[model samples]
Target: MNGAFSLLIPVYRGDDPAHFAKAFSSSVGEQTVKPAQVVLVQDGPVGDVLAAAIDHAVESSPVPVTRHRIEDNVGLARALDVGLTLCEHEIVARMDADDISLPERFARQLPVVEGGVDLVGTGMFEFLDDGGAIVARRVPRTGHDEISRYARFHDPFSHPTVMYRRSAVQRAGGYQPLGLMEDYWLFARMIDAGASVENIPDPLVMYRVGAGAYARRGGQAQWRSELELQRALRRIRFTSRWEYVRNVSVRGVYRFVPEGVRKIAYRRLIAKG
Candidate 1:
Protein backbone atom coordinates (compact mmCIF):
# COMPACT_ATOMS: atom_id res chain seq x y z
CA MET A 1 0.00 0.00 0.00
CA ASN A 2 1.31 3.45 -0.93
CA GLY A 3 -1.01 5.43 1.37
CA ALA A 4 0.78 7.20 4.20
CA PHE A 5 -0.33 6.99 7.83
CA SER A 6 0.71 8.65 11.08
CA LEU A 7 1.33 6.74 14.30
CA LEU A 8 -0.11 8.34 17.44
CA ILE A 9 1.25 7.35 20.87
CA PRO A 10 0.53 8.92 24.26
CA VAL A 11 3.12 8.71 27.02
CA TYR A 12 2.16 9.35 30.62
CA ARG A 13 4.23 9.71 33.78
CA GLY A 14 3.42 6.17 34.79
CA ASP A 15 4.80 4.60 31.61
CA ASP A 16 8.18 2.87 31.78
CA PRO A 17 10.86 4.67 29.80
CA ALA A 18 12.49 1.51 28.50
CA HIS A 19 9.19 0.05 27.36
CA PHE A 20 8.29 3.28 25.61
CA ALA A 21 11.56 3.25 23.68
CA LYS A 22 11.19 -0.36 22.63
CA ALA A 23 7.57 0.19 21.66
CA PHE A 24 8.58 3.07 19.41
CA SER A 25 11.42 1.07 17.94
CA SER A 26 9.12 -1.82 17.05
CA SER A 27 6.04 0.12 15.90
CA VAL A 28 7.86 2.75 13.88
CA GLY A 29 11.49 1.82 13.26
CA GLU A 30 11.05 -1.89 12.57
CA GLN A 31 7.69 -1.79 10.82
CA THR A 32 7.55 -3.34 7.33
CA VAL A 33 5.40 -0.40 6.23
CA LYS A 34 6.65 2.67 8.06
CA PRO A 35 4.48 5.52 9.14
CA ALA A 36 5.02 8.84 7.39
CA GLN A 37 5.27 10.57 10.77
CA VAL A 38 5.15 9.69 14.48
CA VAL A 39 3.12 11.92 16.78
CA LEU A 40 4.21 11.48 20.41
CA VAL A 41 2.03 13.16 23.01
CA GLN A 42 3.50 13.78 26.42
CA ASP A 43 0.32 13.51 28.47
CA GLY A 44 2.06 15.25 31.34
CA PRO A 45 5.52 16.14 32.60
CA VAL A 46 7.49 12.93 32.51
CA GLY A 47 10.56 12.43 34.69
CA ASP A 48 14.05 13.14 33.41
CA VAL A 49 14.65 9.54 32.38
CA LEU A 50 11.41 9.26 30.41
CA ALA A 51 11.97 12.64 28.82
CA ALA A 52 15.40 11.50 27.71
CA ALA A 53 13.89 8.31 26.33
CA ILE A 54 11.38 10.27 24.30
CA ASP A 55 14.11 12.54 23.00
CA HIS A 56 16.24 9.56 22.04
CA ALA A 57 13.40 7.89 20.17
CA VAL A 58 12.54 11.07 18.28
CA GLU A 59 16.14 11.75 17.39
CA SER A 60 16.63 8.17 16.19
CA SER A 61 13.32 7.72 14.38
CA PRO A 62 13.56 6.97 10.64
CA VAL A 63 10.46 9.03 10.01
CA PRO A 64 9.76 12.54 11.26
CA VAL A 65 8.63 12.48 14.92
CA THR A 66 6.60 15.35 16.35
CA ARG A 67 6.22 15.80 20.08
CA HIS A 68 3.30 17.51 21.82
CA ARG A 69 3.34 18.21 25.55
CA ILE A 70 0.46 18.71 27.94
CA GLU A 71 1.17 20.73 31.04
CA ASP A 72 -0.87 18.29 33.13
CA ASN A 73 -2.08 14.73 32.70
CA VAL A 74 -5.33 15.10 30.83
CA GLY A 75 -5.68 11.32 30.29
CA LEU A 76 -5.52 9.23 27.09
CA ALA A 77 -8.73 10.42 25.43
CA ARG A 78 -7.79 14.09 25.46
CA ALA A 79 -4.15 13.43 24.69
CA LEU A 80 -5.11 11.32 21.67
CA ASP A 81 -7.57 13.96 20.56
CA VAL A 82 -4.77 16.52 20.54
CA GLY A 83 -2.36 14.14 18.81
CA LEU A 84 -4.91 13.38 16.09
CA THR A 85 -4.99 17.04 15.06
CA LEU A 86 -1.22 17.05 14.63
CA CYS A 87 -1.32 14.03 12.31
CA GLU A 88 -0.49 15.16 8.75
CA HIS A 89 -2.18 12.22 7.10
CA GLU A 90 -5.77 11.02 6.83
CA ILE A 91 -4.97 7.52 8.11
CA VAL A 92 -3.90 7.29 11.76
CA ALA A 93 -2.78 4.29 13.78
CA ARG A 94 -2.93 4.10 17.57
CA MET A 95 -0.16 2.63 19.69
CA ASP A 96 0.37 2.33 23.41
CA ALA A 97 3.58 3.27 25.18
CA ASP A 98 4.27 -0.28 26.38
CA ASP A 99 2.92 -2.46 23.57
CA ILE A 100 4.96 -4.14 20.84
CA SER A 101 3.49 -3.93 17.36
CA LEU A 102 4.63 -6.78 15.11
CA PRO A 103 6.77 -5.82 12.09
CA GLU A 104 3.95 -6.44 9.63
CA ARG A 105 1.26 -4.63 11.63
CA PHE A 106 0.99 -1.64 9.37
CA ALA A 107 1.65 -3.72 6.28
CA ARG A 108 -1.38 -5.80 7.24
CA GLN A 109 -3.77 -3.07 8.38
CA LEU A 110 -2.97 -0.28 5.94
CA PRO A 111 -4.17 -2.23 2.92
CA VAL A 112 -7.52 -2.80 4.63
CA VAL A 113 -7.83 0.93 5.25
CA GLU A 114 -6.98 1.59 1.62
CA GLY A 115 -9.74 -0.79 0.58
CA GLY A 116 -12.30 1.66 2.02
CA VAL A 117 -12.42 0.29 5.57
CA ASP A 118 -12.79 3.29 7.85
CA LEU A 119 -11.44 1.54 10.92
CA VAL A 120 -9.42 -1.65 11.27
CA GLY A 121 -8.22 -3.48 14.35
CA THR A 122 -6.39 -6.76 14.92
CA GLY A 123 -5.95 -9.35 17.63
CA MET A 124 -3.09 -9.11 20.14
CA PHE A 125 -1.03 -11.36 22.36
CA GLU A 126 -0.70 -10.62 26.06
CA PHE A 127 2.82 -10.84 27.42
CA LEU A 128 4.06 -10.23 30.92
CA ASP A 129 6.09 -7.15 31.84
CA ASP A 130 9.31 -9.15 32.17
CA GLY A 131 8.99 -10.09 28.47
CA GLY A 132 8.07 -13.67 29.07
CA ALA A 133 6.22 -15.90 26.63
CA ILE A 134 2.88 -14.92 25.22
CA VAL A 135 0.33 -15.94 27.82
CA ALA A 136 -2.95 -15.47 25.96
CA ARG A 137 -4.51 -14.00 22.85
CA ARG A 138 -7.42 -11.56 22.64
CA VAL A 139 -9.16 -11.93 19.29
CA PRO A 140 -12.14 -9.90 18.15
CA ARG A 141 -14.72 -10.53 15.47
CA THR A 142 -13.44 -9.81 11.95
CA GLY A 143 -16.60 -9.29 9.95
CA HIS A 144 -18.39 -5.93 10.07
CA ASP A 145 -21.80 -7.39 10.91
CA GLU A 146 -20.37 -9.66 13.55
CA ILE A 147 -18.40 -6.76 14.99
CA SER A 148 -21.49 -4.57 15.33
CA ARG A 149 -23.44 -7.39 16.91
CA TYR A 150 -20.63 -8.19 19.33
CA ALA A 151 -20.11 -4.57 20.36
CA ARG A 152 -23.28 -4.57 22.43
CA PHE A 153 -21.79 -6.88 25.07
CA HIS A 154 -18.06 -6.44 24.64
CA ASP A 155 -15.42 -4.28 22.93
CA PRO A 156 -15.03 -5.98 19.59
CA PHE A 157 -11.71 -4.31 18.70
CA SER A 158 -8.47 -4.13 20.57
CA HIS A 159 -7.90 -0.40 21.00
CA PRO A 160 -4.13 -0.41 20.61
CA THR A 161 -4.28 -2.34 17.36
CA VAL A 162 -6.70 0.05 15.67
CA MET A 163 -5.94 2.05 12.51
CA TYR A 164 -8.71 4.38 11.46
CA ARG A 165 -9.53 7.26 9.16
CA ARG A 166 -9.02 10.66 10.76
CA SER A 167 -12.09 12.13 9.09
CA ALA A 168 -14.34 9.29 10.21
CA VAL A 169 -13.23 9.64 13.81
CA GLN A 170 -13.63 13.41 13.83
CA ARG A 171 -17.03 13.17 12.21
CA ALA A 172 -18.05 10.76 14.96
CA GLY A 173 -17.07 13.51 17.47
CA GLY A 174 -13.49 12.46 18.12
CA TYR A 175 -12.49 10.89 21.42
CA GLN A 176 -14.74 11.78 24.28
CA PRO A 177 -13.53 12.11 27.88
CA LEU A 178 -14.41 8.71 29.30
CA GLY A 179 -12.31 6.90 31.81
CA LEU A 180 -11.39 3.34 30.87
CA MET A 181 -13.85 3.10 27.97
CA GLU A 182 -13.01 6.06 25.80
CA ASP A 183 -12.01 3.92 22.85
CA TYR A 184 -15.16 1.84 23.09
CA TRP A 185 -17.37 4.91 23.30
CA LEU A 186 -15.69 6.56 20.34
CA PHE A 187 -16.03 3.36 18.31
CA ALA A 188 -19.72 3.11 19.18
CA ARG A 189 -20.23 6.59 17.81
CA MET A 190 -18.21 5.82 14.69
CA ILE A 191 -20.30 2.74 13.99
CA ASP A 192 -23.52 4.67 14.60
CA ALA A 193 -22.33 7.26 12.10
CA GLY A 194 -21.98 4.46 9.51
CA ALA A 195 -18.19 4.13 9.34
CA SER A 196 -17.14 0.84 7.80
CA VAL A 197 -15.17 -1.19 10.33
CA GLU A 198 -13.35 -4.51 10.35
CA ASN A 199 -10.92 -6.50 12.46
CA ILE A 200 -8.22 -8.93 11.30
CA PRO A 201 -7.69 -12.00 13.49
CA ASP A 202 -3.91 -11.73 13.38
CA PRO A 203 -2.11 -11.00 16.62
CA LEU A 204 -0.40 -7.85 15.37
CA VAL A 205 0.62 -6.43 18.76
CA MET A 206 2.14 -7.84 21.94
CA TYR A 207 0.32 -6.22 24.84
CA ARG A 208 2.28 -5.76 28.07
CA VAL A 209 0.60 -6.84 31.25
CA GLY A 210 1.97 -6.41 34.74
CA ALA A 211 1.11 -8.60 37.71
CA GLY A 212 -1.32 -5.96 38.84
CA ALA A 213 -3.04 -5.66 35.47
CA TYR A 214 -6.01 -7.75 36.52
CA ALA A 215 -6.35 -5.89 39.79
CA ARG A 216 -6.37 -2.62 37.91
CA ARG A 217 -9.40 -3.79 35.98
CA GLY A 218 -11.42 -3.92 39.21
CA GLY A 219 -12.04 -1.28 41.93
CA GLN A 220 -14.67 1.42 42.27
CA ALA A 221 -13.23 3.74 39.66
CA GLN A 222 -13.37 1.06 36.98
CA TRP A 223 -16.88 0.11 38.01
CA ARG A 224 -18.00 3.71 37.63
CA SER A 225 -16.52 3.86 34.15
CA GLU A 226 -18.19 0.60 33.25
CA LEU A 227 -21.54 1.95 34.35
CA GLU A 228 -20.97 5.10 32.32
CA LEU A 229 -20.15 3.06 29.23
CA GLN A 230 -23.26 0.94 29.62
CA ARG A 231 -25.40 4.03 29.97
CA ALA A 232 -23.83 5.59 26.90
CA LEU A 233 -24.46 2.47 24.88
CA ARG A 234 -28.11 2.53 25.92
CA ARG A 235 -28.46 6.23 25.12
CA ILE A 236 -27.19 5.65 21.60
CA ARG A 237 -29.72 2.82 21.13
CA PHE A 238 -26.78 0.61 20.35
CA THR A 239 -28.12 -1.73 23.01
CA SER A 240 -31.66 -2.38 24.09
CA ARG A 241 -32.63 -2.43 27.78
CA TRP A 242 -32.14 -6.20 27.89
CA GLU A 243 -28.65 -5.88 26.43
CA TYR A 244 -27.81 -3.13 28.87
CA VAL A 245 -28.98 -5.27 31.75
CA ARG A 246 -26.93 -8.18 30.49
CA ASN A 247 -23.81 -6.02 30.22
CA VAL A 248 -24.32 -4.55 33.68
CA SER A 249 -25.08 -7.88 35.32
CA VAL A 250 -22.13 -9.61 33.76
CA ARG A 251 -19.44 -7.01 32.93
CA GLY A 252 -20.26 -4.89 35.95
CA VAL A 253 -19.98 -7.85 38.28
CA TYR A 254 -16.64 -8.74 36.81
CA ARG A 255 -15.31 -5.35 37.83
CA PHE A 256 -16.33 -5.78 41.48
CA VAL A 257 -15.04 -9.31 41.98
CA PRO A 258 -11.75 -10.24 43.63
CA GLU A 259 -8.68 -9.76 41.49
CA GLY A 260 -7.81 -13.43 41.35
CA VAL A 261 -11.32 -14.45 40.39
CA ARG A 262 -11.48 -11.69 37.81
CA LYS A 263 -8.22 -12.89 36.24
CA ILE A 264 -9.48 -16.44 35.99
CA ALA A 265 -12.80 -15.38 34.53
CA TYR A 266 -11.06 -13.13 32.02
CA ARG A 267 -8.65 -15.79 30.80
CA ARG A 268 -11.31 -18.49 30.62
CA LEU A 269 -14.39 -16.57 29.57
CA ILE A 270 -13.30 -13.42 27.76
CA ALA A 271 -9.75 -13.84 26.47
CA LYS A 272 -10.31 -17.38 25.30
CA GLY A 273 -8.03 -17.50 22.30
Candidate 2:
Protein backbone atom coordinates (compact mmCIF):
# COMPACT_ATOMS: atom_id res chain seq x y z
CA MET A 1 0.00 0.00 0.00
CA ASN A 2 1.29 3.47 -0.91
CA GLY A 3 -0.63 5.35 1.76
CA ALA A 4 0.98 8.48 3.14
CA PHE A 5 -0.42 8.08 6.62
CA SER A 6 0.81 6.37 9.76
CA LEU A 7 -1.26 4.85 12.53
CA LEU A 8 -0.30 6.14 15.98
CA ILE A 9 -1.43 4.18 19.03
CA PRO A 10 -0.47 4.65 22.66
CA VAL A 11 -0.65 1.61 24.96
CA TYR A 12 -0.27 1.51 28.72
CA ARG A 13 -0.07 -1.28 31.29
CA GLY A 14 -3.71 -0.89 32.27
CA ASP A 15 -4.86 -1.86 28.78
CA ASP A 16 -5.66 -5.44 27.88
CA PRO A 17 -2.91 -6.13 25.36
CA ALA A 18 -4.60 -9.26 24.07
CA HIS A 19 -7.60 -7.21 23.13
CA PHE A 20 -5.33 -4.51 21.72
CA ALA A 21 -3.51 -7.04 19.62
CA LYS A 22 -6.80 -8.11 18.12
CA ALA A 23 -7.57 -4.51 17.16
CA PHE A 24 -4.08 -3.93 15.83
CA SER A 25 -4.17 -7.14 13.83
CA SER A 26 -7.40 -6.18 12.15
CA SER A 27 -6.37 -2.57 11.49
CA VAL A 28 -3.12 -3.44 9.83
CA GLY A 29 -4.15 -6.73 8.24
CA GLU A 30 -7.42 -5.61 6.74
CA GLN A 31 -6.98 -1.95 5.77
CA THR A 32 -7.89 -1.18 2.17
CA VAL A 33 -4.84 1.07 2.02
CA LYS A 34 -2.32 0.01 4.61
CA PRO A 35 -0.45 2.67 6.54
CA ALA A 36 3.17 3.48 5.90
CA GLN A 37 3.95 2.48 9.47
CA VAL A 38 2.32 1.73 12.81
CA VAL A 39 3.82 3.74 15.62
CA LEU A 40 2.94 2.07 18.91
CA VAL A 41 3.89 3.97 22.03
CA GLN A 42 4.47 1.89 25.14
CA ASP A 43 3.63 4.40 27.85
CA GLY A 44 5.01 2.29 30.70
CA PRO A 45 6.00 -1.14 31.81
CA VAL A 46 3.48 -3.83 30.97
CA GLY A 47 2.93 -7.41 32.10
CA ASP A 48 4.38 -10.42 30.28
CA VAL A 49 1.05 -11.10 28.64
CA LEU A 50 0.80 -7.57 27.28
CA ALA A 51 4.44 -7.58 26.21
CA ALA A 52 3.98 -10.89 24.46
CA ALA A 53 0.91 -9.57 22.72
CA ILE A 54 2.82 -6.59 21.44
CA ASP A 55 5.62 -8.79 20.25
CA HIS A 56 3.20 -11.04 18.43
CA ALA A 57 1.50 -8.10 16.79
CA VAL A 58 4.80 -6.66 15.59
CA GLU A 59 5.82 -9.99 14.22
CA SER A 60 2.56 -10.53 12.37
CA SER A 61 1.84 -7.03 11.14
CA PRO A 62 1.57 -6.50 7.39
CA VAL A 63 2.99 -2.98 7.63
CA PRO A 64 6.16 -1.96 9.43
CA VAL A 65 5.59 -1.55 13.20
CA THR A 66 7.73 0.69 15.37
CA ARG A 67 7.55 0.69 19.16
CA HIS A 68 8.51 3.64 21.36
CA ARG A 69 8.93 2.69 25.00
CA ILE A 70 8.68 5.02 27.99
CA GLU A 71 9.73 3.74 31.39
CA ASP A 72 6.94 5.43 33.33
CA ASN A 73 3.33 6.11 32.56
CA VAL A 74 2.92 9.72 31.52
CA GLY A 75 -0.74 9.38 30.46
CA LEU A 76 -2.32 9.39 27.00
CA ALA A 77 -1.83 13.02 26.03
CA ARG A 78 1.89 13.11 26.70
CA ALA A 79 2.36 9.67 25.22
CA LEU A 80 0.56 10.79 22.06
CA ASP A 81 2.69 13.94 21.90
CA VAL A 82 5.75 11.74 21.89
CA GLY A 83 4.14 9.33 19.45
CA LEU A 84 3.24 12.15 17.08
CA THR A 85 6.87 13.19 16.81
CA LEU A 86 7.81 9.64 15.84
CA CYS A 87 5.22 9.34 13.08
CA GLU A 88 7.04 9.19 9.73
CA HIS A 89 4.08 10.36 7.69
CA GLU A 90 2.53 13.82 7.54
CA ILE A 91 -0.94 12.40 8.23
CA VAL A 92 -1.42 10.46 11.46
CA ALA A 93 -4.40 8.40 12.47
CA ARG A 94 -5.13 7.91 16.16
CA MET A 95 -6.34 4.60 17.49
CA ASP A 96 -7.11 3.39 20.98
CA ALA A 97 -5.53 0.20 22.14
CA ASP A 98 -8.80 -1.73 22.21
CA ASP A 99 -10.80 -0.08 19.43
CA ILE A 100 -11.23 -1.68 16.05
CA SER A 101 -10.69 0.39 12.89
CA LEU A 102 -12.94 -0.60 10.02
CA PRO A 103 -11.28 -2.03 6.92
CA GLU A 104 -12.14 1.03 4.82
CA ARG A 105 -11.20 3.59 7.48
CA PHE A 106 -7.95 4.65 5.84
CA ALA A 107 -9.36 4.61 2.34
CA ARG A 108 -12.17 6.90 3.41
CA GLN A 109 -9.99 9.27 5.45
CA LEU A 110 -7.06 9.58 3.06
CA PRO A 111 -8.77 11.59 0.35
CA VAL A 112 -10.04 14.11 2.86
CA VAL A 113 -6.63 14.61 4.47
CA GLU A 114 -4.94 14.74 1.08
CA GLY A 115 -7.58 17.20 -0.06
CA GLY A 116 -6.32 19.65 2.60
CA VAL A 117 -8.39 19.02 5.68
CA ASP A 118 -6.20 19.41 8.73
CA LEU A 119 -8.25 17.06 10.89
CA VAL A 120 -10.83 14.45 9.94
CA GLY A 121 -12.84 12.19 12.22
CA THR A 122 -15.70 9.80 11.63
CA GLY A 123 -18.71 8.37 13.40
CA MET A 124 -18.27 5.33 15.61
CA PHE A 125 -20.24 2.30 16.69
CA GLU A 126 -19.84 1.89 20.42
CA PHE A 127 -19.97 -1.67 21.68
CA LEU A 128 -19.98 -3.30 25.08
CA ASP A 129 -16.82 -4.85 26.41
CA ASP A 130 -15.47 -7.62 24.18
CA GLY A 131 -17.50 -6.07 21.33
CA GLY A 132 -20.08 -8.84 21.21
CA ALA A 133 -23.13 -6.57 21.48
CA ILE A 134 -23.94 -3.20 19.96
CA VAL A 135 -24.44 -0.46 22.50
CA ALA A 136 -24.95 2.73 20.47
CA ARG A 137 -23.94 4.53 17.31
CA ARG A 138 -22.41 8.01 17.44
CA VAL A 139 -22.72 10.11 14.29
CA PRO A 140 -20.84 13.29 14.92
CA ARG A 141 -21.49 16.49 12.95
CA THR A 142 -20.04 16.18 9.46
CA GLY A 143 -19.36 19.68 8.11
CA HIS A 144 -16.87 22.11 9.60
CA ASP A 145 -19.55 24.60 10.58
CA GLU A 146 -21.74 21.97 12.20
CA ILE A 147 -18.77 20.49 14.04
CA SER A 148 -17.65 23.90 15.26
CA ARG A 149 -21.14 24.64 16.56
CA TYR A 150 -21.60 21.29 18.28
CA ALA A 151 -18.12 21.45 19.76
CA ARG A 152 -19.31 24.28 21.96
CA PHE A 153 -21.21 21.80 24.13
CA HIS A 154 -19.82 18.39 23.21
CA ASP A 155 -16.81 16.83 21.51
CA PRO A 156 -17.46 17.13 17.79
CA PHE A 157 -15.04 14.40 16.85
CA SER A 158 -14.35 10.96 18.21
CA HIS A 159 -10.71 10.87 19.29
CA PRO A 160 -9.98 7.31 18.24
CA THR A 161 -11.65 7.85 14.88
CA VAL A 162 -9.59 10.92 13.97
CA MET A 163 -6.92 11.41 11.32
CA TYR A 164 -5.00 14.66 11.65
CA ARG A 165 -2.28 16.40 9.75
CA ARG A 166 0.87 16.31 11.84
CA SER A 167 1.86 19.87 11.02
CA ALA A 168 -1.56 21.23 11.95
CA VAL A 169 -1.41 19.52 15.33
CA GLN A 170 2.16 20.65 15.90
CA ARG A 171 1.19 24.21 14.99
CA ALA A 172 -1.62 23.98 17.53
CA GLY A 173 1.07 23.10 20.10
CA GLY A 174 0.35 19.37 20.10
CA TYR A 175 -1.58 17.57 22.81
CA GLN A 176 -1.93 18.98 26.30
CA PRO A 177 -2.03 16.75 29.36
CA LEU A 178 -5.67 17.42 30.11
CA GLY A 179 -7.01 14.58 32.25
CA LEU A 180 -10.16 13.17 30.66
CA MET A 181 -10.48 15.92 28.09
CA GLU A 182 -7.17 15.89 26.32
CA ASP A 183 -8.64 15.22 22.91
CA TYR A 184 -11.28 17.85 23.45
CA TRP A 185 -8.64 20.29 24.58
CA LEU A 186 -6.54 19.74 21.48
CA PHE A 187 -9.50 19.91 19.11
CA ALA A 188 -10.71 23.12 20.68
CA ARG A 189 -7.29 24.66 20.26
CA MET A 190 -7.07 23.43 16.69
CA ILE A 191 -10.38 25.05 15.88
CA ASP A 192 -9.16 28.24 17.51
CA ALA A 193 -5.97 28.02 15.46
CA GLY A 194 -8.01 28.01 12.24
CA ALA A 195 -7.38 24.42 11.36
CA SER A 196 -9.72 22.89 8.81
CA VAL A 197 -11.57 20.10 10.56
CA GLU A 198 -14.35 17.83 9.33
CA ASN A 199 -16.02 14.53 10.16
CA ILE A 200 -16.99 11.80 7.72
CA PRO A 201 -20.62 10.82 8.00
CA ASP A 202 -19.75 7.17 8.42
CA PRO A 203 -18.86 4.87 11.27
CA LEU A 204 -15.20 4.13 10.69
CA VAL A 205 -14.44 2.56 14.04
CA MET A 206 -15.91 0.26 16.66
CA TYR A 207 -15.35 1.80 20.08
CA ARG A 208 -15.24 -0.44 23.13
CA VAL A 209 -16.98 1.07 26.12
CA GLY A 210 -16.61 -1.00 29.22
CA ALA A 211 -19.06 -1.17 32.16
CA GLY A 212 -16.96 1.18 34.31
CA ALA A 213 -16.65 3.84 31.61
CA TYR A 214 -19.32 6.11 33.05
CA ALA A 215 -18.07 5.58 36.59
CA ARG A 216 -14.66 6.75 35.49
CA ARG A 217 -16.11 10.06 34.31
CA GLY A 218 -17.29 10.98 37.82
CA GLY A 219 -14.59 12.17 40.24
CA GLN A 220 -12.84 15.35 41.38
CA ALA A 221 -10.00 15.19 38.86
CA GLN A 222 -12.34 14.81 35.91
CA TRP A 223 -14.56 17.57 37.31
CA ARG A 224 -11.64 19.94 37.57
CA SER A 225 -10.58 19.04 34.06
CA GLU A 226 -14.08 19.68 32.74
CA LEU A 227 -14.19 23.09 34.37
CA GLU A 228 -10.76 23.92 32.98
CA LEU A 229 -11.85 22.82 29.52
CA GLN A 230 -14.93 25.02 29.69
CA ARG A 231 -12.89 27.97 30.80
CA ALA A 232 -10.41 27.40 28.02
CA LEU A 233 -13.22 27.20 25.49
CA ARG A 234 -14.64 30.47 26.74
CA ARG A 235 -11.21 32.09 26.60
CA ILE A 236 -10.81 30.92 23.02
CA ARG A 237 -14.27 32.25 22.20
CA PHE A 238 -15.45 28.76 21.31
CA THR A 239 -18.29 29.24 23.75
CA SER A 240 -19.83 32.32 25.31
CA ARG A 241 -19.51 33.06 29.02
CA TRP A 242 -23.07 31.95 29.62
CA GLU A 243 -22.49 28.73 27.79
CA TYR A 244 -19.39 28.11 29.83
CA VAL A 245 -21.22 28.67 33.07
CA ARG A 246 -24.11 26.53 31.97
CA ASN A 247 -21.79 23.72 30.93
CA VAL A 248 -19.89 23.82 34.21
CA SER A 249 -23.05 23.92 36.29
CA VAL A 250 -24.61 20.93 34.56
CA ARG A 251 -21.48 18.84 33.99
CA GLY A 252 -20.15 19.65 37.44
CA VAL A 253 -23.23 18.21 39.08
CA TYR A 254 -22.91 15.12 36.98
CA ARG A 255 -19.28 14.69 38.03
CA PHE A 256 -19.91 14.89 41.78
CA VAL A 257 -23.17 12.96 41.76
CA PRO A 258 -23.40 9.28 42.64
CA GLU A 259 -22.00 6.86 40.09
CA GLY A 260 -25.44 5.34 39.56
CA VAL A 261 -26.94 8.72 38.68
CA ARG A 262 -23.99 9.59 36.45
CA LYS A 263 -24.33 6.25 34.67
CA ILE A 264 -28.00 6.84 34.01
CA ALA A 265 -27.32 10.37 32.81
CA TYR A 266 -24.53 9.16 30.59
CA ARG A 267 -26.71 6.42 29.14
CA ARG A 268 -29.64 8.74 28.55
CA LEU A 269 -27.80 11.85 27.42
CA ILE A 270 -24.40 10.81 26.06
CA ALA A 271 -24.81 7.20 24.99
CA LYS A 272 -28.08 7.92 23.25
CA GLY A 273 -26.60 10.86 21.38
Choose the strongest candidate by TM-score. Answer: 1
- Give TM-scores for every candidate, taking all chains together and pairing residue i with residue i: 0.97, 0.94
Estimate candidate 1's RMSD in Å.
1.1
State the lDDT at 98 in candidate 2.
92
The global Cα lDDT (0 to 1) of model 2 is: 0.87
Candidate 2 colliding pairs = none
Model 2 weakest 10-residue run by lDDT: 264-273
lDDT of 1: 0.92
Q: Candidate 1's residue-wise lDDT over 1-273, tens digit each? A: 358999999999999999999899999989999999999999988999999999999999999998999999999999999999999999999999998999999999999999999999999899988746788998778799989888888888889999999999999999999878999999998998999999999899999988899999999999999999999999989899999999999998999899989999988765756
Error of 1 at 234 (Å): 1.0
- Candidate 1's TM-score reads 0.97
Q: What are the per-model C-alpha RMSD values against the true structure?
A: 1.1, 1.9
- Clashes (backbone N, CA, C under 3 Å), per candidate, total 0, 0
For model 2, what is the alpha-carbon lDDT of residue 26? 65
Q: Which stretches of candidate 1 lie over 4 Å from their true place?
A: none
